[model samples]
Target chain A: MPDSEGHPDFDELELGAVLTALADPIRRQVVAVLAGEPDGTERPCSSFGLPLTKSTLTYHFRLLRESGLVRQVNRGNSRMAQLRRADLEARFPGLLALVVAETQQAGKGAPSVAGNTARAPH
Target chain B: MPDSEGHPDFDELELGAVLTALADPIRRQVVAVLAGEPDGTERPCSSFGLPLTKSTLTYHFRLLRESGLVRQVNRGNSRMAQLRRADLEARFPGLLALVVAETQQAGKGAPSVAGNTARAPH
Candidate 1:
């Protein structure tokens, strides 16, 4: 229900900052949660199953909102978060999907190889 | 033709470390160059047009090689660098091409909008 930040200006955020914000797997997981849900579906920060404390969860959401990676709005006792996919792709083509796809790739429902460097081209 | 680092091994790198290494735009450009070249082509580090001191350039390539993002082999006066695409994808699917594609997407032949954030979602 509270507006983003002391001043929520979506136009001024930078892509690098957003990418850096999402670089953390926890934050990426949060974004994936929003990405998986429909645009107006409000999911509380607690829904992501991240083990961080509430303050940390708030910080993560703040970073995502400031990075323009998500749009957050207060809705009664809980806040609703939505992925700003259109806004992101418009500014940086193919970035949002690539990152989203990366999260899914990283979470391959199976066990992972110990280490992987670039193996597939194209 | 100098071998990578004081030693060379491909199996010991970490994905997060590799991602952190490629997070820099300049380093990403270097990866782009190697990605565009044929597997065996030997383009010297000087070929990338980055305006950094030799030591810094050496550092970047070293990071790339050690991260398993590229394989460097002694080939006469210059070292040949090739993307270890197969190795990367096997370990982390959809990362290399996504990054390479991101580089190409970033270097738009056309001018970029002053700013763009997610505006599209699939």
Candidate 2:
């Protein structure tokens, strides 16, 4: 798979960068949505429906992409993002699943997609 | 349990803070040491033998305590730290184990105890 410029390659993925990227509630929420997709779906950034402004959304997406958590591509007129699930699992088994499961658990009352910050899993 | 001032309470733990605390290689190593300890044993921070300055070590411990990943208590002349395993598991099931496992996996050859940055799972 071709990676965009500025994104870390598979071998370059480091624990610190990945954890830092996932450490943000917004980014974790984004990963939750993408990782939960059944068919490796790539969704437009707008589909996340985060309350963050466009710039903030861009920043979070960039962090995720740079850390190798998400892959972004320019599709038609919109930029779409998808979780690098296989790569992450290969490098760090149980890590992403824990993150997604914890996020989902913490955001149960008000899912992070609804704009509320995830509570427990952070 | 009585948390010292500035430490996040059990109910106050947030996923972002925990992930950010773990994002640092040194801190992850510290957590690794403590989490691997038998019977929830608390150890003096110096026992980890990290190569950082004392101030830097103190800083990492504080970050861990603040994020609810570790708890510290004064024992005689030394302050001891231990992983808040039960609390973390209660708040974020499977999260801490994933972090410790991933950190261990990433630091397989060198072992973070020796001061090398973890290679993968970042």
Candidate 3:
């Protein structure tokens, strides 16, 4: 049985972290795929098909998991990921809807480039 | 007349930039205040009461403007800021709502700290 040992609790999920994690195009693409799946569906790490190296993909998955956006569990020799849809909806309602909507929009030929590169103000 | 010269067009507003801009707590607070105000209500930059230095605040405002989350225009001696609610709603539905909701939730005594500091995967 997979235990939720490393996942942040629902209350521990911060808005900034969630937003930051979802800000990446690749992470958002991963989230979009997860959002399309049925509830409680667990996908192997290799199932994402992201155009990146294995190490880069691993990093993205770790960020998503740490941000409380997705839950990852070790299954046999591979890692499985699942979007914490219910937890996210309970904490930040309508957030996933926007991600899914944006993904759909991008899929309809909208460019997914980050046009604005405003530096973070310290 | 306030011309939208520096602001990105609705189509040019990228999800990553918008999310990156909103990921900062200070910027999100500014957006939350604007969301609470009436439609088309423009407030001077000094009205936000943020703890950041003047330069830092200005940077945040500029980032928000560049990201298409807020519009800043010079009104006489002061720079006034307004939430581009309509534009955001049209571009990414439920996005501003999530910001507003998160703000409200934070205001309800939740700690608004960015607990998850997972580095951005490049």
- The deviation in Å at residue A101 for candidate 1 is 4.1
Tens digits of lDDT, candidate 3, A7-117: 898899888889988888889888887887778777766776567889988888889998899999776666778899999998888788888877777687643432222
lDDT of 3: 0.80
Per-residue lDDT tens digits of candidate 2, residues B1-122? 45485678888988788988887778887877677778479898888888768898888888988899888888789888878889988777766666567566666586545323545542
lDDT at A118, model 2? 24
Give fnat for candidate 3.
0.72
Better of 1 and 2 by DockQ: 2
In the range B13-105, model 1's lDDT, one tens digit per residue, is 454566666767777767666666556445666666677998998898888887788787765666656678667766656566655666565
Per DockQ, the best of the predicted structures is: 3
Worst 10 residues of 1 chain B by lDDT: B113-122
As a whole number from 0 to 100, the lDDT of residue A53 in candidate 3 is 89
Report clashes for each candidate as comma-separated counts: 29, 7, 0
- Between prediction 1 and prediction 3, which has the larger TM-score? 3
Task: State the weakest 10-residue window (summed lDDT) of model 3 chain A.
Answer: A113-122
Name the top lDDT candidate: 3
- By TM-score, highest first, what's the ranking? 3, 2, 1
Which parts of model 3 have CA positions greater than 4 angstroms off?
A1-3, A109-122, B108-122
Question: How many backbone clashes can be found in candidate 2?
Answer: 7
What interface RMSD does every candidate have? 5.3, 3.1, 2.1
